[model samples]
Target: MTSDVRDTAVKDAARHEARLLWAGNRGLFALLAAARHTGPIARVPKLGWVVTDPVLARRVLNDHATFTMDGEGGVGHLWTQLFGPEMAQFFGGARHAEVRTRARDLFTEDGARSLVERSQGPWYAELARRLAGGETIDVADATRVLAGRLVSDLLGLPTDRDDDAFRAVFAAGERLAGLAMGTTASTELDPEVVERAREIVAEITSGVDAAYRAAGAGTILGRCREMDLGLPLARGLATLLAIAGTETGASGTSRTVALLHDTGQQHALLRDPGLMENAVREGLRVSTPAPVIGRHVARDAEVEGQRLRAGERILLLTYLATTGVGPFDIRREYVPETRQLWFGGGRHLCLGAAVARLQITRMLETLHSTGRPYRVVSRRAARRVLVPTYASLRIETHD
Candidate 1:
């Protein structure tokens, strides 16, 4: 077939598969089946277009020469708008490394320690209070509030006092979620979405700008500005941080809670509180908030005897990979010394992974330590949107 015909065929198949995966529960099972039967499945005309075998996943993510994390293939345009033009370019190759390095200091162990001590504690207290009211609460929204508060604290933004700013961030998250789920057309831009996007950008920019101005002249943002990274880069980092920090945490928390309640794993963890850490890791491994990470084929590459041309998009189903879909087994613990790749394999590995772990660990600890018997009142699939996330996790505390 001609390249155009091939491309059209792949696109059509991807759309159908995306709908089934996003619209129903079968997508989850399909992922598991793909992982089990084949090392990697080149699914055409279904919900998941490609299931990256463990080996292939390792190769694609690790071999920067073969695949790039520029987010260029399918949903690149949508991310470009959300992350801004300059930020989008940085996600590609060498530029991505440069920009990622500048912001690395903020996500380091020390940085996370400071954030947890100064910020997370307060956020946790607030969440506990809200739950203490004895009313059934949406865990998803509660988690979002916690994540949002963390972002606000980190950027020195006035989120807690400013409901308008908080709402804007929440709305931007909603729009981005829609785009990620494949439910919304990338070409169709909603003016309201645009306004919300602009609001989030402005709020984040203003927060970082204020931080720069208030710093004793040698802060992180100050150093970036001095290095010629400019305000836009700062803004981009802040924006990216806000989205990544909030949504991932929110989704992970709600899903972990739901999974625990549904599987009766929460009680086990509560019985042995020290196991909370392990449970957190297992939850992440099982549900994997960011289940799908995409890459663009930088050049021609072959996997499992199939050839993929340059510029073709491939998705790494990390969540599926974790569920014993391939060679790796989730039943085994991820010892840093023994495990191959979990937080990603290559240079594009998640920068905020450490902080993310810390936040998740803390949240799980808090939940278990509460000693309140809580059960999932209702658990349902989230609305069709770009990113697949749990729509609501209603829990009722009994004791």
Candidate 2:
């Protein structure tokens, strides 16, 4: 496609994306829209500090001592309310480092590829076969099931059940994450909300106790037992896995599929299968599933000439930071300043980054398996949720 055509296509894709944001969370859509012109950093009323620059966001994320996850404005604070202060150790304590260290091998690139294939390869094959037969598939719903399956396999949750069981797994995680929708301004949750969140957490961890007891050494719960971390924290960690791995992975997968179709890049990718990796990178870069990252100002610090006092909160607008570079282009090179701000930075960088990338790549491969571009039949944006995503995106191979 010509430059003009590609630009128009990109804008069209962006408009649909904007609608998803608006439908899902109007407040976030407004913040991102306004941040475009707010320069690098700005202080917003009631929302604390907002960082739009990728470099600045990375700086704040990397400054663990100055910006923390366990205080009033951080994600850890939200978790502590539901799981209790003991759960705070998973955020900032030495236990955090130890857990990541122990779980490191499980998230490595090779490990991620193995895990995806072992847990989800058959599903992808079946999806590709269905598409080839010209059957419309709900990409959005399928992703949720696929994500749930991966999480269950990873945690040694029972896999003898059907897709509905896994969908229930994903729904429980989504409801739990939705509870945090009101936490943008403050990380503290009301007693009622905390109670509700705990109920959802219990649903997510219903199988954890059994898994922890009998899971093989290869599973995360079994590893927790080997570490003697006890059942409560193990349940907390299991719930964390459900949230961290489910919504974001499903959102990224479906959104990427929509982007490739909407932007008319499917043809380019079909012509050159070697661009598969580029397509995946560009998809995650553009979708930016975990858009806003919250950090507590642990100590006074200066960033880009602005002084951030201790106890204040800062919201890193990662979605804006990542997308500001340009529209999605499979040929786009790696960005240095932004790095992987979408996954975060420093010691807290997303442990599942590799798995997320591979999952998206695998989805794209499955769609292209028949050597034909797919067409979007219809889509509906998920509303009243923390993450902006499709509730259902129907598609089939183009005739």
Candidate 3:
């Protein structure tokens, strides 16, 4: 039994991550590979401090006064370049807290479950039916549409369009995120790239104008309007949410499905159905979809005996840090050091963590409801994108 679960056709977690990184962004792949041997906190020549330790990474994330998301290598800097300094306020200032606090109720455990059921329940039922009938399903494609659907539902976009519209929404978000691939040396975009980004953002947010005006208070667009955050900043936030919600969620969900099959843990999971939560957590941990997180040093500070000056950037190798514990195991317990570092740490922790988890959980549950394990028929990795994801993963379940 132990061997049956332990020795299976490996999906190769390391190889999968490496392939995704290499194919999606060679520059980032090279950086992470080179820095693999660095200390928990090592200062590189140009990139400054590179943290491979989850504890230190969380420390940096929690220390907003020292490290910020507003300037230089931080994600906020990218938004400010695209929108304006007003968007920067949402990243580093009190408005960050205000927005998160206001939207807090919408991301709680119950809230996440409710959101998933409201936005994606029907799709799951259909997927289960198909898989149970021994039909091959493209998990990756489904995940992309599912991610888009959830984001659309949250922003109160016109759900009137079919899944293709949301798939395009996901693609637009992908293109916008892809623009950041060349941002290793600098997060500042060239004029042409910025122009392209504007075009993409406009295309994706075409419905935002109407949603902002008519969306209810519970919706994100409506909340932005209620907060009196002008149109430009609201658009920036919407774009951020779209990309953040889609890329990571899709990657994590599909990868988790592949991981469980490759690890041959589906039978163990089948026997002890109570392990569903751990299976989801383990999947997310091993995948660590949003692998590297960047931050700009706002003020001078000494971390792990290394002095970091303001205006420098740090890259936290989140994928390596979290997965370093061991291979994918559905029975694995929560590790204190990692402590959900994949979703990120500190006040800026992903607002969609619950939503992402619920999505993956629902996918696993759908597969479990088939009353048998599934097999991966084939898989393809996504290329030239910001997030490492499966472009396609076809799986079939047996009775």
Q: Give the candidate number with the greatest TM-score.
A: 2
Worst 10 residues of 1 by lDDT: 323-332
Cα TM-score per model: 0.76, 0.98, 0.97
> What TM-score should be assigned to candidate 1?
0.76
Best prediction by lDDT: 2
lDDT of 1 by residue, 1-399 (tens): 466754554354334333434553444445545545655757444332365456667776777767765544434445566556776666664666765676677778888767765666875665566567766767766666667667776665654464455645655665555544431212334566656667756754666777655543223455456556667766776666677777777666766676566545566676667676666676666556666666667788777788877866677776666645322122345644213344666776767777777777776665554587687676555555434456666776777
Error of 3 at 157 (Å): 0.5
Q: Write the per-residue lDDT of candidate 3 for residues 101-170, one digit (tens) a residue.
A: 8888888999888889988999999999998787899999999898899999999997767989889999
**Which regions of candidate 2 fall more than 4 Å away from where they truly are?**
none
lDDT values of the candidates? 0.60, 0.90, 0.87
True lDDT of residue 245, candidate 2: 95
- Model 2: how far is 13 from its true place, Å? 0.4
